[model samples]
Target: MNYFGIIRPAMVTCLMLMLYLAIVVVSLITGPSGLDPQLLSGFSLSPVTGDSEMANVIVTWLLLPRTLMALLCGAALGAAGVLIQGATRNPFASPATLGVNAGAMLAIVLGSVFLPQFTGQFPVVVAFSGAILTTILVFRLAQAISDSPVNLVLIGMAMTLSLGALSAGMLMFYENRLDGLYTWGAGNLSQFDYQPIQRSWPIIGMLTALALLFARRLDMIELGTEQAESLGVNVRRTVGLSLLIAVLLSSTVVSQVGMISFVGLIAPHIARGLGCRKVWLRLLVSTAVGALLLLVADVAARLIPLLISDSHYSFPAGVMTTVVGAPFMLFLLTQRKRVSALATTPGETGIQALFHLSPVTFLSALAFVFLLIFGFSLFGNLDLQWINLRWPRVLSAAFAGAALGVSGLVLQTLTRNPLSSPDVSGLTTTGVLFVVLGLVLFPGLGSLEMTLLSIMGSGFALLLLLGLSRLTGFNPLLFALAGLCLSAMAATLISMVLVLGSNQSSEVLVWLSGSTYAVTSERFYLLFISVLAVLPLLFAMWRRLDILQLGEYLPSLLGVRIQATVAILLVMVALLSAVSVAAVGGISFIGLMAPHICRVTGLSSHRHLIPATAMMGSILLVGSDWLSRTVIAPFEIPSGLLVSGAGGIYFILLLLSGKYIQRR
Candidate 1:
């Protein structure tokens, strides 16, 4: 390396170390109890003696431990980030992006709920187990989808959402029992004593050292598997070791600190941006940078309580990380040097090519739908009389699923990208956010009023996605990134509202989870009528969709009103998405899955694709709803979760099939 390269990185590292120390001092002095300037006068004496005794007590018991824990956790995260980014060969890779933190949080929450005794004592083990499982799942899914960074991150995002939903559902279900879990879930850095620090530091120190040992191998692996292998590196073992170290470091912090967001992601990136590309130097700089970033965030978390004048409203340090991290992620997305387009083959075909849907097949599909409705509605019910009352539930599931399926089909067609869907494109989250906003701003707002706001929100989100995609050239990865960013923003907004409006949050949570249990006749008709009117309109525009499918320029050459046609269809998608969100509360992936399945089955024509997708969607959601109701009988799970989880898995399968992997 050049002298300047070494000197520059070393200088940055030193500066960062100094900055971290400065923050540590600041954190040590400031607390809920005001800092005393006179405490500095007693530096000559023992810490526990002299005029600084009270100051020593405050620093020793409270600030000292918390600050130390932050430093340790931040350093671990920074090292883990470098390891993950190196192992994945993706600059964007981090603990959060790989679903490690979410997985760890899920395990921790579940343990606290079901295995309370063991969790309180062995949280780190439980957390590590969860993180390991999640890491494996993410890697498996990424392997299936292609080792492309975008694909891995996409799968990771799906995993994060699925795991997060599971955690949220569990927490909501046991809301009464899990009193302190919420604050912990948000990742508080407050320390009553030094127990966490005492228990945590040794493990962190060892892991950091282990990570450094892997630095040279990681650098080789970054050269590509073939190159690394040629250079006498065992690529698989290195990757495995790297991932294990990364997961352990990250999960350890999560176990102790709840969930510190973005430290892993930003630390390594900042180090690399500052010209620290050599593995060892980058690791050191990243560690210091992470410590500084987190210490600053913790300080802000402490000071914000003072600014707000409400100690009860103290912002969790984790929340602040996300607040900073999300926009940074978005900026990184826009900065991606290149992205591969989804693969296209002439005359695409799916399972439908093997078995033609004759009149009998149509009848069979219809019979199956009715049977699903019956199975979901009447099966195992002690009260047969209540079968009549279940029609609303059945209809609600069918209507919402059908709407989402058709919406997904419309989005895929309009975008000419199979990965495009209402949920993935962010319409569903936007709609849910709008409804939540309505509920917060107007507590007495009826379903009708909320539905209107949802439609507006979905439309706005769609427009925003389109605008951003225009800038990104409609690259599927960028599109998904935009959607994820929008979703995160919406989720953050919902979290804030929930924290502020604690009393009514449960009702909002239920709606966001996409439950069918609350389907009243009014809501049922609203969704049912909306689907009935829109499905036929969708059919009428099938020819236009087909024409547009020929390519944008060709369609215009063929006299298709491209702009007006796209605008109308997209509006229809927004409407359908809003209706589904209104009825089922952000049911996702159904819109992505149903149409994808149909297209894979060789139904390429819009005529076949749209209706087939709608039918499949109806089946998927009805079945999901059935599972939701019966999975833990008498206590329903949200159909949305089942659909989202299944769809995410199916999407991964498609990626794993190797057809989607673009050769450079």
Candidate 2:
């Protein structure tokens, strides 16, 4: 018997199946109430028939439903992963990456809010529709952009963040109505009945059957559309059907079990790594792998509360997946070969042919900013208290936005990476985490101490990212990916602190969401000074930045002290990012968005680009702050949320326009 040969096909499959079944049994045994033998008996064909009502209740009501749900959701996501990967021929594609999970979650929330009477299948249908729509939107956006597989994921991420913000806003607006939704949105797996399993299983089973039925066609489609068409495949129909089924499966799981993050992504990759090349085998193996992975995560989620002896701390299963999956995603990114030329450069002639800023245009923009900052008010009547209150908030927004804009401009130019920004570069996130950690550890840490701590953290993060880039042979994508991973880790830490800490402070919540509500005149003064100090140094180095943009080798050959230049600029970025984090608490991507917008709006040179981007940033943030205040008056959304949601959409539009895709 050739264990490695095709005839016998190895014993790995049988072993894996046994392992999965074992895990299922283990999951059933472990619960909030611990293992019960009579519970097992209750689940068996014959009822316990003894004084085992408690055991029967636990099995019938709680343990059986959730364990079964974990298996079903995991299997569904796994099958969805195979279909998505096959359809797109992109290894990184998944429900989370394609914005399907976010869209479905949003749909469920809306359905719950609007159609309270519609139950059972209504949310599933709405979620499925949302997922399909998001998929189509992402596909169209990616098509409009460059053909790089990476673009699909980027656009999807932007869409995901935007949709997430919208859903969060909805949840906030109706928090009383949807009281337990916050926990559920984080992906809870608690089941009091067998309804979710009963509802989700049929849809998942049908999707799995469809995947197996269309396996050959999907396999052919992976060989490129032209080749597939040549091989007598209706390429478009096959691709569309595969994606539709994939989204349906994914959205169904989300509707039933909340937002499980990465099972879909990790499963198919594991199957392929294990040499499951044939489509049917891969689909089955992926499904099994996903089911097993999620079952373990769900078990861990259940056990966490027990371990901590705090049942109030209901750690969602999705957070467990994220804790594992985020690092896995980072590992996959680290494995990519060094690939540079990720940043788009404006043509030399375009940069050289600089236009002077028109006085009228400048003042007009300034006037617009003034009107937005001062003219708008939610409270109809203004008084001395209002004047004092409003100005500081407005100034805080402006200064933070300007700092972000300048930080982004410098980081992008220095790294020569369009994707570089305070948030995406991991600066703001690290800074926020460091400050939050300081709050947890020191207990009585002052605002000033927190600011200094965050600044140091931002500096450390920048240095660490630089070190990673150097080790990775300066691959822009690798730098971006590493930064993204760091950011995810920081975000996870923040979430843990928010959920688990004793304080559970509303002030901290406001800060984490990037609110200006907590910004005092004192804080505004600190931020203003920081911005003023940073801008001058940035202006002085603007010409050097322009010279350096002519490729790395040329700058050094042209007598530029490349190392000194990068160090100084990075310090500047760190300082600016730290201040914004201090003031606004992770107002992200303004740096990414503002500089890109400046270039598109004809401010390509560093001289014009730096100041123009700063001005634009101020306008952007202030306007966002105004909108945040006014959008649903009396119940304000965070300025950070508004900025991020709007900026993410704008960045996607930029990608769709083929503006940011660099031709190397």
lDDT of 2 by residue, 492-563 (tens): 667666666646444476677788887877778888898899899899988899988897688888899998
Name model 2 segments beyond 4 Å from true: 6-10, 33-51, 119-121, 308-312, 337-360, 367-382, 415-419, 440-444, 502-505, 655-661
lDDT of 1 at 344: 20
For all predicted structures, in order, the TM-scores are 0.85, 0.89
Clashes of each: 7, 0
User: Number of the top candidate by lDDT?
Assistant: 2
Cα lDDT of candidate 2 equals 0.78
lDDT of 1 by residue, 1-664 (tens): 5899679657875886687677777787766644445544433354455546766677767877888888888888999999998987886678987889999999999899889999989988899899999889888866755546776776677677777777777777788988777777777888889888888889988888888888998888877899999999999998999999889998899988888877898999888888777898899888888887888888877776555444455567787787687677767766536333322221221222333455346545655775666575555476877766777777788878888989888876665556667877788988998898788767877768877989999989988878877666666556776777677667666676666566677777776878787777788888888889989998998888888777647889888998888888888889999988887787878887787666554465687777777777778887887788788888888888777667766765675564343332
**Candidate 1 overall lDDT versus native:** 0.77
Backbone clashes in candidate 2 total 0
